[model samples]
Target: MTPASLTDLKAPAKLNLFLHVTGRRADGYHLLQSVFVPIDWCDTLHLHLRTDGQITRHDLTATLPPEDLCLKAARLLQQHSGTSLGADVHIDKQVPWGAGLGGGSSDAATVLKGLNTLWGLHWPTERLAELAVQLGADVPFFIHGRPAWVEGVGEQITPIELPQALFDTPVAVLKPPVAIPTPAIFGSENLRRDEKPAIVADFLAAPKQFGCNNLEEPAKAYSQEVVQALEWMQARFGNSRMTGSGSAVFAWVDTLSHQRQPFTPADVGVSDLTQTGPWVGRMCRLIRQA
Candidate 1:
């Protein structure tokens, strides 16, 4: 049975602990090896079922495009399931766009999972995850809903149990006013296409030492803002690195100090803030999935 209302469902952001571009497929997809962990920082989604069979959206924040991933996910699910039911999707977005934190993908995944419950679909996660793969590379990871070692253009997933020390580690995620394009980073000649895959045991043995992002160099080159943000985090906290393809970087901090300061363009001149600071960030804890 469908719920009367599904409101304020969270779509959490994910950090790629280490991103290694191992090889390229003939179809131009980049094969990768990375550890993806969900953080507490999240976007909020509210859903109300519609009987008219028309999916629509209401933006609590004007930041997203009209045809964003959430809308696409809803449409895809409706089409695939042949459901006459629809949804009025309302989004209160928190995750930054194009930061490589997989915000869009997470939103889509949340929609898929939430709708499965709200629409009375009763589909298993494995089946929903298969549908999620069509939306984006990172969508399936969110559907899988756990810390995992991700591979094969983000399709293959192996669940990993993190140590308690690393599981509750505090992280400072900082994003400068910039967006790093994934295509540009992958297309760059400087990108390393060959990195020996590390075993899970090695990473488990020394998670801190194993944490690194291969996309960092290209991302830094793409935006000076990314460089400054990374440097700032590095100076404040040790073991700093870019998360995904770029624009946002994070560092493992022993203690988290939550302070919201307005970010000015004079900081980098790349900010897109109309009101809120163009530079957005958060201090989050990695909560291990049961």
Candidate 2:
């Protein structure tokens, strides 16, 4: 057995704080505005640099593929920069797929960052962001690795420093037992594409009630039952929205928030469907150690 010379990177999950489909382009691309924040929840990646040209991956998640966008980004950078080293990658997964949390995109960005340092490419952030956009619309923001308000196919990003210390709120992420095909949600006739734009200051001022995910209607139309989860989440907390597309929903509430009344116990249990593969996950607040 040989030790894998690797660098560990945190591939964090992201939520589209709110999504608005401003317009559809001639090429069928949707213009939109939203806030994207990387939560503590994440997938883990370990990259072991190989002197030879060996781009390999050991994926532990059921939904993700070995040759996913992460590896693609690495290869793409290697080709563009002419990096001489290759690497073996391993992932210990926790983020759910098809839930619009940007788990995959984050992993891809982590790879780009890792390889840039491991191979001594020293590519600038602007160069990496450009390459990321070539990979996926959500790719560039992950490299930014900060809370941002995104627009225009998610490529346009402006990082906002969250008041993490000032407003210490608890987050609850619920992934229902379903896998949503993003294309299906986009192509579905019932998708809602209408939402008036708002000033960015409106979001920063009162993020709890600035906007909502316009992609929700179409996502529910395809899945046909997430409405219940959406309703439940909203009823439980003041701030709730469908993150990205479908299947996963999240709420923001105080950690000590009363979940049930003294006289009656409220039903807080989300539905769990026993799909062949893993389905339904509850993400607890990932505490950071000083």
Candidate 3:
């Protein structure tokens, strides 16, 4: 017999206002300070409760693990509260993985949040946030789903309200055919690690406080195919930037009248996502598609 019922959930993507690596710990944890802003685009996660004490997952889209952070999040919550109920997880993914959009982290955070409700754990957001950090550095920000000033390896967070108009501007998400691994980019000795840190209060006060991703340059160099994708997006829209590491770049377009959901349209001639060279991406307005 199941102890509880099922519920639905949404996991959104995030953009970093700016990422700064202040220092590195002896244990190899890179301390950081960045402002996280949740855009309307997201991945959908559905959860069903179970009585048999089993936790399983089904990905409706591509197969991914991102080091199994989603599963780890559920296990962490269960261990922390000692909840007996289990969850059958279904991920209806739209957020592109390794796109510097915080998709995986958001998915993990959702599990933490969803299970808390499904199992009747009754943990507050603050408590759930602490548990999220154990799963990943970016998990806490998604729990709040607000623009935030992040510090201390992204564990420390101060939420802020961004102008809703950012979404009004249509943004195009362009993913190159390749994947840029986060670990590899961060591990490179040439990657900049000397930037100073900032306080949360001041950063939120001015959202565009600093420049874009510090990892963008090196990341593109590592993935030449991503450079092509960036070029395509820029050709169609105005200004563009590479999010997070690399392999995915985005641009701002004013109108997305044709798209039911906000999206950057595909390359007219390109259909295959793995062609690796020049593929047309889609055009969508800035809204949470998943």
Candidate 4:
């Protein structure tokens, strides 16, 4: 007997510890390599089963686009599974959009996972992930619910364990009001497309100070806010990097110096930064698993 409702399903956000662009495909898709880890900041979802075969979504927090990924995911699963059961999905969005935080993809993945159980599909994670990739590159990562080494335009996912120093580390993620369009960043002539390919061993050797985000250079050109956010983080943490592509940048709260005292949001001047502009800041921990 499957439950009619599943409430409080969480859709977590992810950070690209490191994102590299190795090459471009014939179809103009850029090849990428990155270590993606889930964070504690998340969106909450509530799902209720329906017998009338009508899928609906209600936004509880932030307003989503009319045809957001969550609705698409539910329709995709319902169609693929040939299930007459439908769902009324209510999303309590917390993760900020256009921050390159994978919020939409995470919500879509959660919808698929939650509906799979509610509808009694009993499909394996692999099956769910297969559908995930069709929706977006980042959706599969959330479906797997683990820290992963992602490559090849975000389809290839190899789960990896993080070192203790990186795991559960406090991070300050700051996002400006502007949303940098991903296509604009990718289409920019200045975007780097030929970074040398890296391996898991290379990242493992220095997870904290790994390879840089190839997309950041192009992203900065599109938005001065992006530049400001990066500068703000770097000033406080001594190092800051953009995650994925756009408007959000993050830094580990504590520095690498073993003798240095640990820092928190107050020590890093989060309040001052927020006061200066329409910046959203969160003190989050890097989770080992989603």
Candidate 2 per-residue C-alpha lDDT over 1-290 given as tens digits, one digit per residue, 9 for 90 to 100: 33446455788887777788887888998888988877877888888879897788876456566568978998999899987789888888777777898888888898898888777778898899999998998889888887777888878888776555323665667676677888887887876676677678887787766688887888777664467667776776655678898778877765463422221112344434333334454534423320
* Model 3 lDDT tens row, 154-220: 7888765555555566566777656778898888765787776666556545443345666776787
* Whole-structure CA lDDT of model 1: 0.82
How many collisions per candidate? 0, 0, 18, 0
Better of 2 and 3 by TM-score: 2
Per-residue lDDT for 1-290 in model 1, tens only?
A: 56867998989999988888888899999889999999988989999988889888888356667888889999999999999999888878888888999998998999999889888999999999999989989999999879999999999999998888876667778877678789999988768888787789988887866847888888877877778787777666655789899878887766544223322333323344424447876777786751
Clashes of 4: 0
Write model 4 residue lDDT over 121-206, tens digit each, in one string: 99999999999999999999999988999999999999998898876468888878778789998999879888999988989999
Q: In model 3, where do residues sit more than 4 Å from their true spots?
A: 1-3, 60-62, 65-67, 196-210, 254-274, 277-290
Q: On lDDT, who's better, 2 or 3?
A: 2
**Best TM-score goes to which candidate?**
4
Of models 3 and 4, which has the larger TM-score?
Answer: 4
TM-score of each: 0.91, 0.87, 0.83, 0.93
Output the lDDT of residue 198, model 1. 76
Give RMSD (Å) of candidate 1 vs. truth: 3.5
